[model samples]
Structures are given as structure tokens and as C-alpha cells.
Target: MTTPESALPMVVPATDLPARVRIHEVGARDGLQNEKTAVPTSVKAEFVHRLADAGLTTIEATSFVHPKWVPQLADAEDLFPQLADLRGIALPVLVPNQRGLDRALALGARRVAVFASATESFAKANLNRSLDESLAVFDPVVRQAKDADVHVRGYVSMCFGDPWEGAVPFHQVVRVCKALRDMGCDELSLGDTIGVATPGHVLELLSLLNEEGVPTNVIGVHFHDTYGQALANTYAALEHGVTTVDASAGGLGGCPYAKSATGNLATEDLVWMLQGLGIETGVDLGKLTATSVWMAEQLGRPSPSRTVRALSHQE
Candidate 1:
């Protein structure tokens, strides 16, 4: 006997969800690198260690960019070596240029990420180059990293919206994504740098990328929570077959280049939703939230993550 449609239970479509989602924790590098005060190298190492202890397999450790640009991460050389012995964790460092790649390679980095902007305004503001010019600069860096047998992740920022240029076109984002993939990037992460994307926009962009032959499996989503749409956008991406999602512990960092940008989607928050949805993330929420609370105390501020705050209050 068929029940009436109204009597059917409301359940999330199983076919629309992934069995396992990989949460790429970026709090160490993307989170702390934007802070005004410098974090001690020891504390940074401890933070990474704690995240690993919480079963976060992929933790972005640090960036090897020029000290003049991101002085907060000037201790990358000292930091990378300390994390070398961490078992079962993939530590990816951000390399802005060939020089940065050389520094990372010298320290035995196994994975590195290169960034590119999807809009001309962001390119000029962040990299001091035009859109095409920035991609040109990252070309050799990606190639060299590939030659060194180091995995490379390509990040395209300002994918949905830009502070200087409003409402970026979908084609512009796809072009950059294809360029990154063609340059040997093992995976491409689309960044909503200013955090203005909605779920509708995310679905449209991912759909367009799929139509253009970009494999959704090799694509990741990086969202900021400025507009409170990060989680919604992430859900949309996951529905579209994107399995990798970038998040920060405690919602730690924002883009310095994009002033209006806010903290990233918190890893704890993401985990909470994923766990409720029956998705396997291999993370311990208790330990992850505790780590965020500890880091927040070190920073002398409360965490922006709602899950962390609620869990901390309960404790």
C-alpha cells in the first residue's frame, strides 16, 4: 500500500550525499597567518599536533611566503621540521612563488598549495598583478612542485564575489580552474574569499564547472562565514559531488587582502553538521572543540564557532 506523499517521512536524499567527506583543516596556516600578533612557533606546532591528535588527516601546516608579506608565518622553516614526524597526517604548505617553493622544498615539504585570484581587482590587490599575470607566476611554481614529486593544490580565490569587482562571472572562474588543472594541480579549491556566495550561486557554479568537464571529485570548496552562508554553500557543493571542504578550527581566519572577509567556516561546526547527517569525517568533535577552546585561550579571545562556543559553555 502506497502512503500519501504528505505522510512520507522527510529524509535527506541519500543519493545526494557522500558516504565520506574529507574536511581539510586550514586553521593553522589560513587561520593564524591572518592574525595581527605573531604566534610562537612552539604554540603553532602544538596546535597542529593537537588537530592531528583529533584525527584530522589533512592539516595545512604553514605557508612559505615571503616574510615581508606574511610576517606571522616567518617561522615556517622552524615550524615545518617539527611537524615532520607526525604520522598519518598530510601537511600542506602554501608557496606563493618559486622562491617560496624552494624554501618549502629545502624543508622537505611533501605537499604545497599555490593560489590564484579569479578577478582582476583581487589579483591587483592581493598579488599586485593582473588575473592572467598571477596565473603566469604560479605556472612555474606548480610545475616545479610536480617535478619534485610534491602534491600541489591550486586555490582560486574570489570565486563567487569580489570586494572590488562585484558578482564574478562563472566562466571566469572555470577558466582559472582549467588552467590550474592543466598545470598539474592535483586538486583545485574554489574560495569564496569575501564570503558572499549563496547556495544557489554555489550550485550554479559547480554545475557549470561540471558541464565544462571539470571533475567534481578533484574540486574542493573553501568558504568564509562573513554572510553566514558558508555552511549552506558547503551543503550545496556536497550535493553536487564535491567531497573536499576547507574549514578552520574555531572559525579562526579571514583574508587580509579582502578586508570585508570574515572567519572561515569552523571545522567543529562542519563536523557537527556532518555527524548529524551520518557522514564519516574521522574527527573527534570533543577533542577538536577542546583544541579550539585551548587555542582561543592562547589568543585571548573566544572562538567564533557556534559549536565550539556551545560545547565550551556546556563544559
Candidate 2:
């Protein structure tokens, strides 16, 4: 009993929704980086290839952090070279410090991301430094990357609520975001690391960021689905004029530092919603879901995405 296109339910998008949205696919780097078992370098390369084939223009390839911290991506150096031929794709890598940056630069990485925390407790736990200290550390890294013509993205974690420090103050989040922008980060991704944010929280944060003079165009949202609020929060962000949305394929990531944090908003799920809303993302829903299903098998787990489950059942 399929409904005809003309008879299907109509969705009136909020006036603020952009004509096109940039999906920042963080599956390879952010997704796999948190897996307990290390993914094979060959499989990782194939993952990136499949994502690119699915028309994800901006895919985060890998992280250059020390293997001691994120052993799941220990093969970052080996995995990067295999992706050299992805033409017209922006493959950004995560670099924790100058050492990580050096490794990425050596691999000819054209784009890199640095991480910061909006909460002092998370900062101390995640980076082993205070918020100010973490910003200082990334300053040189961003500067060096920009000087080398490499694009830089700054990630501000725990933007909505912190586990240790509940309901993080608006000023705290704004300060970190401003610091990242001041450090010359080309873009900033506000992370709801613990997944406690509601639409109201998201809207409030965006408003404050706007009030602080952070351009909406350079802002992105990364939400975790722990409490099933990721999509709701994402919609809130989109309605507030955020053009960039970060998602992981198969919903394959969680925060190591924040134990309660869950997998990210699945790319398949986000794509389904975006396409349904007539928002252009240039991602093939069928292909992206197939890729996630394949990757899930390789990991011996079912994908965490509801859209993937529904689509797979149809087959």
C-alpha cells in the first residue's frame, strides 16, 4: 500500500532551513576511533571509499593522535595514503597536538581538526589540561595548519551539558567557541557530548553563539543519540541556520571520556530526514545505508541506525 508522491504527507520546512546542507561524515575517524577492536587498515580505506562513492563530499578520514590514546586508529598513517586518490573530496584528519599535526602534514593532509572542551571538568579529563591551557595548545596547531594552507576545524565538546558539571553555563560554551574562532579555526563543531540536550537547549546555545557574534555559516552541530534527542536537536540547529552537520555512518561512535555518551547521529538516519525534507545533501540514501550495513557486518554488529534496520528488512 504505497502512497503516491503527490498524496504523501507534506513537510513544510522552517523558513530558516538552508537550500543545501553539508554533511560532514565522521564515520572513519570519529566513528572507528572509539571502537574497542581495531578495524583493519584495508577495511578502513574501503569504508572511506564507500562513503565517497555515496557522495559524501566532506569525510573525516582519520585521526593522527598517538596510538597509545586511540589504538583503534593506530594505523592512521597507513590508512591515509590509501585515500590519496579521492578527488573532489575534503578528507579532514583530527590532530591533537603539534606531533599529530606533524604526522598529518607529512601525510599531506589538506585539512585537520583540533578538539577543545566547553567544560573545565571534561577538558581536564579528556585533554589532561584546563580549558585555557587546551586552547593555548591548539593555537599553534591551528596557526601552523593555516600557514601551510590546511583547513582547520575546531571541536568544542560538551557544549550542552556536562556529566561532571551538569547544565554547562552559556558563557562557558561561548568562551571556548570564541577562543577556537580567535585561534583561526575555519569552522567550529558544537558537540552535545553527553546527549542530554533538548531542542530548547540547542536553540538557546545557537542564540547565544549568534549573540556572541559567531557566524552561523561557520558553525556545525555534533549530537550523540544516547537519549534519542540527536535528530530533534539537529532539527533545532538546522532551523537556526547551521549548514554543517556532523554524523557517523551506522552511528558508529561514542565518547571514551564521557562514559554515558552514545553513538553519534547515524548518517543514514540524517540523510533520510534531510532527503525527506527536500534538503539537498548529495548523498545517495541507498548507497550510504548499504555501506553501513556492510561495515556493520565487518564489525560483527547490527548498525545502530533505525533507517538502516528498516531498509535492510525490506531486502
Candidate 3:
């Protein structure tokens, strides 16, 4: 490959002090959403506690969406009350609409996430609304969350490619991200929901955001391992100043759009990378690995993490 000097940045002094990045552990929600057998709420709570114990400051406990949409997390209401007494863990739950938000607020949720799709088709399939309409639906939710002093996180799915609409434009992504930020979302996770993103694409998208003056600190990346490039893309995002990355422990998530993806970037794999780069994730890799292994056993499957595989027989 002929290297274009302009395509890649010139080598600069590497920062020995690793950038402080927050890893929002999504293994409990995204990881369990697609499974046929619903994981018990006790198991879910245990996983959340384990993740919290591993020094993950933020953990997505579950989704408050309708059980019809995601049967696996139907116990969100049941789970929340049990976890309500626990303190020191920032448990953010996914709320798909006002009803979901209401359910969460009733359980005293302090932080909630509303997800929107960048592509119209995905929005329609996922939320039964057009992109614009979906964005509108979340406006009031964001307002209410803000008024109640609850942090709101917005997710823009399919930032890379869509099953119905291929090759999402960078402009569309920027527009969606801007809209979410404007709606008072404290943070926005630019999701490669169906994956299909490359390092170059990630850098290009971040450059656009930087150009638009969107605060990079409030931006996060959620990548699926569709083409086996999620970690590489994540490193590219790190280099471009993205400090928050979403990963599932044990690589336990797959896209609803099955043909386009498998599991997400494994948390263990991501932590290993961050550790290697001298970044402070605050997550204990050994604990994460052990928890992931236990979770995989409960789910009756092998962990998708390569690091887990290499370390398994050693124990």
C-alpha cells in the first residue's frame, strides 16, 4: 500500500501519561439482549456488581424498554428496586421513550440513556419512527432528565453502515450527533451499531466533530465486531481524542442486524489495549476476565475474547 503522507499524520511525541478514558461497561444490557434464554435478574445484578467491583465507575445495568422489544431485560423494574440500595456505582439504564423513562424514574434512576439511529430505516425498524421523529421523541425526555438533575446519554446508532442504508455519510453522522448534543444530552455515544467502520473512517468522523466544535470529551464510541476491526477502530478513535468507549464483557453482544455483525469489542480485549498504552481505565483486568468467564459459563457459551482464551488454561 502506497502511503499517503497526507492520509496519515506525522509521528509525534507519544504521551507516556495515558489519556484518562471511561469505559462504560455494557455487558449486562447489550450482552444479554439477544439471548434466547433470559438471564435471571439475580445473575444480571451479580454481573453489574462484579463490574462495579472491577473499578468501572459507570455500568449500564439494564434497559427499561418494553419487554416485547427486548424480552431478555424485562426484569429491569424488578432489578432496579433490588439494586436501589447499593451506592457508589453509577448505574445508567437505557430508556427508549417517555414510558421507559417513567419506569426508570420510578425506580429512582439518576442517569438514563435514550438511543436514536442515524439512518431513517434503522430508526423506523428500531423505534418505529423516522430519524427526525425519533429525535423529536427524545427531546422532551432529555429536558425532563435535565430538570430532574439526571444525566442523559444519547446513542446514535449505525454511524458507520446500515443494513437498509449502506455507507452512512459523515455529514449525516455529524448532524445526528449535533442534534443529540443540542437536545441537552450530557454525552453521545457514536455507535458503529452494525460495525463496518475502519480506522480511517473513525478519524474522519472525529475530525468532522472537531471541526464542528463538538466537545470530544462528551463524545464516546460504541463499536460492534462485525469485520473484526472494532479494536483497531477504537485505537484510531483514542488517537483522535475520544475518551469514552463502550465494550461488552466477554464479547457477549451481536447486532440485531445479524448479517452485518457478531459480538462487540470485548471489554477484556479493550482493557488489555488501554493497559498496554499506559491508559488508566481503572478496571482490574484479572477481575474482569474472571467475571467474564463466569458470565459466559452462566450463558452456556465460551467467551469471545482472545485474551480470555489465552489465559483460560493457565488457571
Please list the Cα RMSD from the true structure of every candidate, rounded to 1 decimal place. Answer: 5.8, 2.7, 6.6
lDDT of 1 by residue, 76-129 (tens): 999999998897799999999999999999988889999898999999998999
How does each model score on TM-score? 0.95, 0.95, 0.93
Candidate 2 vs 3: which has more TM-score: 2
lDDT of each: 0.92, 0.91, 0.85
Model 2, residue 157: C-alpha shift (Å): 0.2
lDDT of 2 at 206: 91
RMSD of 2: 2.7
Model 1's alpha-carbon lDDT is 0.92
lDDT of 3 by residue, 185-250 (tens): 999998988879999999998889879878888889999988889999998988877889999998
* lDDT, ranked from best to worst: 1, 2, 3
Can you write out model 2's per-residue Cα lDDT over 90-181, one digit (the tens) per residue?
A: 99999999999999999999999999999889999999999889999999999999999999999999998999999999999999999899
Candidate 1: residue 71 lDDT (0-100): 96
Error of 1 at 228 (Å): 0.7
Better of 2 and 3 by lDDT: 2
Total residue pair clashes for candidate 3: 0
lDDT of 1 at 202: 95
